[model samples]
Target: MARRMVIIGGGAAGIGAAGAAKAAAPSAEVIVYTAFEDVGYSPCGIPYVHGKEIPDFTSLFLAEKQAYADAGIDVRYETTVLGFDPESRTVQVEGEGPSGYDALIIATGFDYKPPGVPGEDLGGLYYVKNIRRAMEWDKILDNVRHAVVVEASPLGLEMVTALAHRGIDTHVIDPHPWALGELCDPDIVAPVQESWAEMGVTTHWDTRLLGFTGDREGHVRTVATTDGELPAELVVVATHKVANNALAVAAGLRTGSTGGLVVDDHMRTSAPHVWAAGDVCEIPHGVGGLPLQGLTGSHAYAQGKVAGTNAAGGERAYQPVYVPWGMVAGTWMIGGAALGEVAATALGVPHVVGKATGISRARYFPGVRPVTVKLLAEPRTLRLIGAQMVGGEGIKERADFLALAVRKGITLHDLASMENVYSPPIGALNEPIVTAAQAGVST
Candidate 1:
């Protein structure tokens, strides 16, 4: 009999694992089970569809159900896995009996952290997940006049912009002093915050949600915050994403402080013949070796590849992560990699900061815009530890490069003298990254 590989969840990580496992062992039996009705779609695109930036939700799908079937992969949708026993090497499906497997991969992903306030169970409260429900909610948003987002998290920021794009009166409430304060420093985030204000979005900074009040229909009508009560017709809880690890914990898998499953360099769990990936598992940060979770879909898929390849009896090692994140806030593009000033201070990592404001193109260029770069380095060795950037066209590229530079142990001296492209339209003569590093070197 061929070896059987069972994967739980059909999100990015699970899909990645299935594909890689099938490729590693062509004759192996690969099966995937997902509680959701759909698979092979980008969850990251959900907010865009809601914002009408994309024409429809169907465009979010990368592949159809038939595509998986044609690849000789059995994808069981809307089928929940009740539990699994590592000792028995069996997975218990909700309706089906136990299915034996030679190897197992758990990529159960994340669930929204509950608001934990009163009236959370009321209607008109939304947690953005499940494409099917988003499709349904997209229609309802057309009629919503006022919406309040619970936090200023990444998803919260996306939802805020989406709602604003729909011309709805949007309000964002957060305990943080500024948007994305947990990640980017205040100065880097200031322009984005201004952009939100220009969009007619109201921000309640340093304010906590007290509770909600509903109308006769049990739908949210008012948002009560420490600041005051705001009339609201809808509420979105976009708080931190907690790992959905009930199944993993029940199966006796070790989990980290981040509530993500603990896995080795090979993505192997504590139990033999089992691996975990995606938002469900925590990996060490490249700089401080701190465990982190709730990362982007790209990270999930890469980790899945390592897990699947190893489960198929192949050799592959997953490396520590220097998470490079970038996104548009209102109209400003801002991003960072590894640690910023705030994060470094919070983590107690001693560092020096270099900052510079340079043009994205030559001074004579038509559409030149200011690009600000900030580099963080260890004070003694001047080794690059993290970076943050906000600009018009080059934020994402610079953030990605800095992540690699940090990984490779690039230092202030290296970037200060680094060469860059120079053109009238696309390239700038003075690279902000190099200038920022020079600032640090001079300091």
Candidate 2:
């Protein structure tokens, strides 16, 4: 009998798992089921498309549904999996009978946390997910003149920039004193906030959302905040990402403190012959083995590959995450790996810090931009615990290097002595990372 491999969800993780599973078990009956009508599109790029940075929504798709069929993997789009019976080893589909699976991979992604205030159900409110809905919203944005983003989250910031670029009066409301407060330190994000302010983005900081008010047509007309009422033709609810764990919970799978399915190194769930990946599962952090969830798409894909390979009777192991994250904030770029000062403090990890400001290219080079690097290390061993960088051009590369360095137990001394490229066009003679590490060593 051919082994049956069933995957739920069609996001990065689900698709990744399906491909790896088919490769590992050539003859396995692989099926991927998703509630969405479309697959293989980049949800991350939705913001850019809305901002008119991309030409069209069609450009975001990586592959068509027919392509999966050609690869011998069954993709059932617009199909929902209602529940799973762990004892019976079967999943109950919404419009089908119980389907048995030799192996199951649950990659159900995330849902935006609701604002949970009055008039949230009113029209003119948008939640940025599901590319189809985003496409519809993109059309609606053409006529919107005033908009308010309910949170200063990554998505919120992106939407703020997008709306402003379209000549709309953009407003951002956040109860926190600074943007991305949970992910970045206040000082590091100050410049990005300043740039947005310069761009004419009205920021309502330290203000709580009281509720939304609607017009006669039930479209949002005003955003009532702790400060006062602000005119808004639309509201973008860009709140926190919460794991969609209803299926996992119903199936009796054990979840971690982060409300994500508990999986070991092999991505195997508590149930036999079942695995979980992506936003639905919580993995340990490299810094202190703390459970972390709601990571980027690359992490989801990699976790899915491991889960799929293992579910197909192949051996694979996933390591703890040194999360490397980067994104353009207003005019500048910001990113970090592992812990930042904010995260370290929140997690109660003791650490010392070193930081430096250097040019991205040679000082005399044209288009040279300032790059700031901050390194955190254990006080005793000086081992690199985390790093954060904010700059014009080199944030991504530095973040990637520091992620690996943190994982490999590289110390401040190692980075300080590390050789770097010194080309005038792109390479800098003085690397900010090395300088930051040298400062750490001196401390």
Q: All predictions: root-mean-square deviation over Cα?
A: 1.0, 1.1
- Model 1 residue 187 lDDT score: 95
Residue 219 deviation, candidate 1, in Å? 1.0
Model 1 Cα lDDT, one tens digit per residue, 1-443: 88899999999999999999988988888999999998888989999998988999999998989999988789999998999999999999997889899999999999999888889999999899889999988999999999999999999889999999999999999999998878889999898889889999999999999999998989999999999998888898999989999999999999999999999999999999999999999999999899999999999999989988999888889999999999877887889899999999999999999999998899887888889999999999999999998888788889899999999999999999999999879889899999999999989
Which residue pairs collide in model 1, if any? Answer: none
List candidate 1 segments past 4 Å from native: none
Ten residues in sequence with the least summed lDDT for candidate 1? 327-336
The best candidate by lDDT is 1
**How many clashing pairs per prediction, in order?**
0, 0
TM-score of 1: 0.98
Off by over 4 Å in 2: none
What local distance difference test score does each model get? 0.93, 0.92
Q: What is the Å distance of residue 54 in model 1 from its true position? A: 1.8
